[model samples]
Structure formats: structure tokens, C-alpha cells
Target: MSNSNLNSSSNHFSCPKGGAGYVCPDEPQFVGCCSQDPCRNVDANSTSPCPGSNLYYASYDPFIHEEIPANACIDGGKWFTCTGANPSFIGCCASDPCKSPDHTGCPDDDLLPAAWSKSRPGQFALFQDEGTADDDELSGGAIAGIVVGAVAALVTIGALVWFFVRRRGNKAAAMSGHRHTSSVIEGEHRRMYPCPASPSFISSWIGAI
Candidate 1:
């Protein structure tokens, strides 16, 4: 496909660079009009590129795995739609396994489109949200997260309470120190005080004077 030059090899022609305007499929495993990059003429007898989504499989392998069931799911299979049918059971997703289904799962031998229906689609439950709340209305992971958040909140509140209590103690100590520091100056003394000298000592001191 990388080579642009193409020529005839035998009954079939090798078109590495397909014909003009022949756009190759995005995936190398996908089917295209021609095997090469740009799809070229299907037959040497003809002069124009193959049209109508008809792919000449030179390198493309429709089936990648043997485990995949259903022919329609193969790579080269056309873009078909049952339209109100189980495309998955019939090999729709098999063609492009990259695009998985989120619907119910299907048994290997299920009756495909014939048994596919809206009321009872298939069995394959594809890409289901395991995180969704279940019968208990709460997922296990969600419950764990809630518990962790609550614990963190409780720790934060406990720390705040301890900090406020310590701050209040410090403020009370400062207030007590201020109360003890208040003093009476000589001229501003309002509180009266009694002298501690004895009455007999005062009478003897008067005889000495």
C-alpha cells in the first residue's frame, strides 16, 4: 500500500496505489474498493476503478479471530442494519470490535436477527455501569467515599475546637496578668490602708520626743 507504482502480476493486477479518488479505509484490517491505498480498477480488462463498495481483498482479512461469531461481524461485511433487530448477535460488532455494545449479552448460538426483538433484545450486557447504585441504592465505592469524607470532616472540626480552647486559655491568662498589674499611684491612691505599728510602741515613742 505504501508503494505508488502498481502493475500486473498475473491474472490479477497489483494496485499498490489504487486508482484516483479511491480512498482507503481508516483501518488496515478494513475492507475497501481495492486492496491498495487508493482503490484501482478491479479488472485489467476494465479501465475504471471498482465502484459500489465492492472490495477486492488482496491484503485485508475480514476475520481477525476465530472466537468472533457471526459472518456479518467480519471485517469486509457491509454496513448492514436489521432495523429493529439484534445486529450484535448477527455479527454487527464483530465487524468493528473497537465499537463495543452496551446492550445485553448474546449466547454464541442465539437465533440472531430472527430471534432479536425490542422487548427481548439479546443477552450481552455490554459496557454496563458497574458504578451505578444497585438494589441497595448505594454502590460500595460510593459508601466508602462518604465514610472517608465524614471522617476527614470530623478531624477538621476536632482540630478547630482544640485551637479555640487553647486560644481562650491564653486570653484568660493575659486578662489575669492585667488585673494584677493595676496599681495605685501616690496622689491617685483611693483605697485606704491601716498602719501595722503597736499602740504601746507609739506611747513610748512620744516620751522620747
Candidate 2:
């Protein structure tokens, strides 16, 4: 069917420049209201900007071969708890496909958009056959980073140890050189001032007698 026919059939309306303020965790394909229940609308006809949380892009789960609930955990489609005045309700993220002007995937077989948990947020789960490729890539990158950091730390420690050892060796060598110079000076003094215990002493004794 044409895009205009889909919009008219669904009774579609535009949300402001950015679209819905809150995401529909149950059916991320549709725009959601800020109330505890995504189905409840504060003012359906109002043209004012949606007053609620920030909008996020839709996260496609290739494993499921479908779009999982917005902001829901990929491991188990677990809904995150919403904070603020409505703490009892769950929060959602990701873009609403139904909000698109082109009426992309928003049209359903009934020619109606998502209405409050129609997508069944609880049903989404990762397929076991393929596993989570994205998560695995992230894990590999994290491991590489840790290894690089460890190597860098070891190199820095080695450099510091070598510097200290070289400085200590030079200091010891200088001290040894000073000691050797003092010893040589003492030996020269002994040679220049010979002891009076030879012919000089004997001549002096004979003269006195």
C-alpha cells in the first residue's frame, strides 16, 4: 500500500521536531507517551513538544532477525526501571519506526501502528545458533586493551629500575676514585719526608759525642 494510505489508516500524527520524548519498551516501533503506561496519551491532539525522556535510535538484533524492545537488554529483553516521578514503570530507549514520515515498517497487517506493548517486549531473546557477535567483538577489544596496558606498565617499571641502578653505580665509582686519590697522596708524602733512621742519624750522634 502507499505511504499516505498507511498514515491515514493508522491515524498517524507528528510529534515535534524530534518525535516522541519517551520510547515504547514493549513496541519500539511506535511512539510512546510519558505516563507509566506507554499506551496512555496525555494529549493526543496537542501540537506541543512531548514532555518526557530523551529519544534514542533503534537497536536491531541481528540474532533475533528482528528489532528487540528499545533499551531492553539483549541477553533477555529485560525492561529497565524508570526513575523520576514514575519509578514504578519501566523505561525504554531507541527510535520509533512508526514515527517515520515515510511509514516504513510502521504499518502492520491490520493497517494499525503499535499500541501499547503490541510487540511483546518480553518475547525478545538472542538466538543460540549465532550467539551475540557484537558483544564478542567488544570483549575481544577489551582484552587487547588490557594486554597493551600491562605491557606498557612493565616497560615503564623496567626503565625506572635501570635508571636508578645506573645512578647508584656511578655514585659508587666516584666514591672509590676519591678514596684512591687520598691513598696516593699519603704515599707521596711518606716518600718526600724520609724517616731520620739512617746515615744522618749516625753522623749526628757521633758529632754530639
Candidate 3:
């Protein structure tokens, strides 16, 4: 029942001999192969036993050999453990939408574990960090989208700033040019008629504009 090798790279197991390898059966007594899973034989409550029961596997056990596809652990989002009515003979789950947490030892993607009843119930179980695994599931597309959005926002902001600055500079340059033109005209008029043009001439030229 030692779950020491649970969820590791290899699925090697160390099953005990005879009646000492089953968990939660009608009795602690179990003999022969580790076929009778304890997840189904656990303490039942209410009218139906396997309708919505959650499956939980022992991280470590002294007398059980946990099977990945066994109906002994509660890890799926929809069904914790398959009832006799909806027994998962072919597969444990169809598709995983409800992602598994970091400590659950599930894949980074939304897929559920291939099997159930992992890690027998006997040895000291090593639980994963209770942190969330959603970050691990971020796809390349999602990350790229975020990066593109950020860059586009920055470029837009820069363009707007440059437009305003260029517009302001143009206005200032125009104003200076107008002032210079006016000064040159006045100076030229004074030099052309040092005695000052006749009131009629002044009125005809400067007053015209």
C-alpha cells in the first residue's frame, strides 16, 4: 500500500501479499490481486452511493496498489467516481474542461488524468503545492495576444504624442514667420520714405491690409 511511487515518471508498484492490499473494502481484509478497489467500497451515505461521489486516492498506503484507471480516486470535475450506472470502463473522462490544480498532479492542459485511484493508501503521501495550475495551461496563442495588445497600445500612444508635438511646432514656426514678415515690411517702408510717406500714401499702403 505504499504510495511512494505515485505520479512519478514510471508507474512501478509494490503490492503487498494476500489480504493486506485492499483499501476501504467491506472490511480492511483483502486477498489476491488488487482488483477490488476501495474507492467504491468506502463508507456510503444516502439513497445512492456513486451518483456524485468525489474520487480521492491515498497518496501513500501500506497495503494497496493504486491503479491510474481504477475507480478509487476523485479527480474529475463532473464525476468524482463513476457509479455503476455510468461506469467508465472505456475511459475515465471524455474531455477535461475543469482544469486540475497544481497539487493534483494533473497535466498542464485541461485534460484529466488517464487513470484513477493513483498511489495506494499506506506510505507517506507527497501532496503538490496547493497553488493553481491555470498559469501552466496558458497557450502560445494567448501569450502572443497579450504581447501584441501591449505593443499596439504603446505605438498608438506614441503616434498621438508625436502628432500633437509636430502640430504645435508648426504653429509656433508660422507665428514667428508672420512676425518677421511684418517687421521687414515696416523697416522697408521706413527706409523707403525716411520723411514718412504722405498720409495719403501711408493710408494707401499700410492701411490697405
Candidate 4:
């Protein structure tokens, strides 16, 4: 190849199919010579890079009928595409978290895209609210309450039993005291009654003597 042709070839941007090129910050792939308009110069039918070769076209438009847009070629992170309408920003340029670095196809997020703003925030919020140790703490408190309640119930039962036993003992003592009082009354009556009647008769006889 001539030096001029070599220079021209060197100036041209060559990348593997579905491969990414040098990306300038805040610049879309369509802004430079690799834009959709420039790719039209190359034929879309051939796979080899020769003069009048459709390899450029084949590279530009892999599926013959549809032309791959310049913006689609730019690496817009892993899952997202940087379109002309919604160009990728610096913050959005990182590798996809869900896909491996070797992966070339669209990310799973893109194939089955989530409602990013709605689903992620809500999921994280729910995790924040319900994913703590509070449940375990609450269960511990409940167990403590049950244990205290059981102890209190046992103490109450013991006190009731003691009170009933003391009451029965007091009743038995009162019955014994009543029986002793009746016996003392019968003994006093036996000692005084006959003495009274005999003393009266004897006093009369002694006065006659």
C-alpha cells in the first residue's frame, strides 16, 4: 500500500463488529466521521474490507435490511443505549452491574427492562422497612412477658393455698375451745348442787339436837 493510502487507512476508524471505539466525554458516536451518514459510503452487502467492498455496509448494517444507527454502536454502559434524543451522560457510562464484561449483546435489563424509577426505589424502600432485627426484638419481648406472667400466676396460686390452710387451722382451734368451755361449766354445776340441798337438811337436824 502507498504511504498516502496507509495514512488514509490509519485515519479511518476500524472496529470489530458490535465493538466499541474511542468515546469522548459527553459526545455521541454519531457526532464524528462514524455517523450514520458516513457509513452510507460503504456497501452493505460484503463482509471483507476491500475497495468498493460492502464490508463497511455489512459492519454498519449487520442485518441487510436494517442499518445500525451510530448512536446504537456507542457503549452506553451495559444495559442502556445512548440515542441521539437521550444521549448518555458521564454518570451513565459505567459497565452494567447485571452483565459480565465479556457480554456483547444487550443487557438483560434492556431485554426485560424494569420500571427503573418505580420498581427499584420501591423495592429498596420495602427492604429498608421490613428487613431489620425489630421482629426478633419484638419476639424476645413477648417471651419475657409470658415468662413474667407465668411466674406471677404461680405466686398467686401459692398464696391462695397458704391462706386456705391457715383458715382451716383457725376453725379447728375455735371448735376445741368451745368443747373445753362446756366441760368446765358441767364440773362447776356438779360441785355446787348436792351441797346446797344437804346443807339445808343437816342444819335442821343439828338445831333439834
Candidate 5:
């Protein structure tokens, strides 16, 4: 009852020869498979008791082949098997949203491997690493947008700084020209009106005039 090559698409599967196979009619023995009559003899060449039936290939010996109930997956997930070293447990595939730190293994963009659990009496859980196929593309686009926005901000700041600096330079040049013009006008006024040689000479000249 080695489930290494278990088919996830079809519900029914075949059991190998000399293996603990053939699920009985009783529900307690195997709940996933269909039951056959006790009087009918099982064919040695045939692998399944009821061929082409949509049922789990659970063997009569519960220990050998684990029995997974029909309602095991509450969220309508299909049963599958892991390909790696963790094939002993039955894996459930579904399109449900998966939470972090526990869920892993994305089969498709929508389908995700919910969890790997044993179909036996007790459940054992195992999870694989998450795939980042589409995430990479999204991250790249985000990074590019950030880079473009930063460049635009830098260009705007540079333009503002240049305008302010040019305006300050123009104002300083105008103030310098005004001071030079006032100095020239004061020089001409001093030349036009010369000072008297002495105070006494200035008094005599005023009286004569």
C-alpha cells in the first residue's frame, strides 16, 4: 500500500500485488473505498476490488493503508501526495488563502497546498517553503516606482535652490551700483564749491561782496 504514486485527479487508485490491499465492506475498516460482497472471490490478477470507482484506495488493514474520510478537508480541497521525503503524509490542495509561518507550497497562482497530514488515526503535519514566482515581478515594479519618484523630488529641490541663489546675486549687484553712483555725485559737489583759505579771508570776501 505504498502511496508514492498516488493520483490526485482521480479519486480511485489501484493496489499493487502482494500488498495489503482490498478494502472491506465495513465502514470502520475503510471509510473511503466502496465495499464488495463477501461471497465473491477476489481476482489475483486484479488490483482493485471495485475498479473505476470514485473512492479512496484504503486497504482493509488500517495500519498499512491509512483511511482518509471524505470530509477530511473541510474547505473542499483535493487529496494529493508530496513528491519529496515527506510523501508518507497526504497533502491537501485547495484555492483557499494561506496565512504566514504555516502555509507553503504554491501549486499555481491561485491553488495552494494547504497542509500535509497523515490519513491514519492521528494527524502529522508538514509544510514546504513558499514560492515567490509572481512576487518578484511585483517587487521589481515597486522598486522602480520609488526610484523614479526620488529623482523627481531631487530635480524640484535643485530648481528651487538655483532660483533663490540667482535672485540674491542680482539684488547684491544692484545695491553695489547705487553706492558707486552716490559717491560720484558727492565728489562733483565738493569740486564745484571749494573751501575758503582761512576764516578771516572768508569774512573779508563776504563783506566786499
Candidate 6:
């Protein structure tokens, strides 16, 4: 078959009326809405008829591939023709073979399109791995900080002990010195109380007596 014929299969291949031979680009290839046939001759049907057909066959711009609109295919074999001029339909069909315009009986969101959840299974494990390393680092820092603080406290306690000891020693020395001075003064006063007679006075008194 020619490349055109091969590519044509990508479009609607059969007629909309469930006929085996007739082919139209505007008509859905499948006999019923659920038919697996592709749309044909999208180049000829620039203006789409059959607005109610759920299936659409159109060539995409830039890639030149045929596409089917999502939820655009119907049971009557007529492709739902989009009157809206937006070329989004073209891109949608070109990318996905099983495009459905209507989300009926379909998932609210396409799991294939939202692929970020695939990595979710291991996310908690990854976070824990990183957190474990961080925790080790934090524990080491805390231990070091505690050691330094304890050493500083010990030094402070030692200094305070030395200060108190030195103060007591000085106080004891001062009290001892004061007591010695008071004893010496009291001894001198007792000697001064007994007055001594002169030698001449003693001789004269002896003679007179």
C-alpha cells in the first residue's frame, strides 16, 4: 500500500453507516459508537458536519498525524464534530490513540498524565534517610556544646573556691595579730601600777627610823 493509504488508516477507514466499503473522512470508521475504526479523509472535510458524532477524525498541525477527539465518538458511527475553531482537538488526537472528549465512565483525572505519583511510594523513605543524617549532625553538635559548657562550669567553681579560701586565711591572720597586741598592752600597765622608791629616799628613811 502507498504511504497515503497506510496513513489513511489512521483516519476513519470505513463509512459511518456500518458499510464495509464506503469511507469518508468526516464519518467515523466504526459502525457503532464503540467501533475501533479510525476516521478517514480529514483533508477533504475542512468544515465538519455531524456535530453530534462523538468521534472526530482530523489531522494535527506541525506533526501531520490524524487524531480523534476525546468523548467525540458516538454509537451511530458519526464523529462528534467540534465547531469550535480551537485546534486543541487536533493536538489531543495526534498524541493519544484513545482520546475521549467526554470524561463519562472515565477517571476524573488521567493517571498517565499525572505521573508524579509514581515516585510517591519512596518519598517518606527518602525524607527519613536525609533526616537521619541531619539528626546525627545535630546530636554531635549538642554533645560538643554540653562538654564545653561543663568544662566552663568546673573552672568557674574552682575559681570561686579559691577566692573563699584566701579570704578566710586573711581574716584569721588579722584576728591573731589583734589579740597579740592587746596582751602586750595589758602587761605594761600592770608594771606601771607599782611605783618604785628612789635610793636616797630609802637611805634617809632608814637613818631616821
Output the number of the TM-score-best candidate: 2
- Model 6 score (lDDT): 0.34
Q: lDDT tens string, model 1, 28-79?
A: 2122223334333334554333322332312111121221122222223333
Q: Model 2: clashing residue pairs? A: none
Candidate-wise lDDT, in order: 0.33, 0.36, 0.35, 0.32, 0.36, 0.34
Report model 5's TM-score to 2 decimal places.
0.33
After superposition, the stretches of candidate 2 with alpha carbons farther than 4 Å from their true spots are 1-141, 198-209
lDDT of 4 at 127: 16
For 7-126, candidate 6 gives per-residue lDDT tens digits of 233432222222122122233321212122233422354332122233333322222121222223222222222333233222112223234454221121211110001122321111
Score candidate 4 by lDDT.
Answer: 0.32
Error of 3 at 74 (Å): 6.9
Q: What tens-digit string does per-residue lDDT give for candidate 4 at 24-122? A: 212121212122222222245522112111111111111111111112233233223222111111112234422434434333232211111221222
Preferred candidate (lDDT higher): 3 or 4? 3
Deviating ranges (above 4 Å) for candidate 5: 1-138, 203-209
Clashes of 2: 0
Q: Write the per-residue lDDT of candidate 3 for residues 121-181, one digit (tens) a residue.
A: 3211212211111324433556689999999999999999999999999999999999999
Question: Number of clashing pairs, model 6?
Answer: 23
Residue 186 in model 3: shift from native, Å?
1.0
Q: Clashes in each model (backbone N, CA, C under 3 Å)?
A: 11, 0, 19, 0, 0, 23
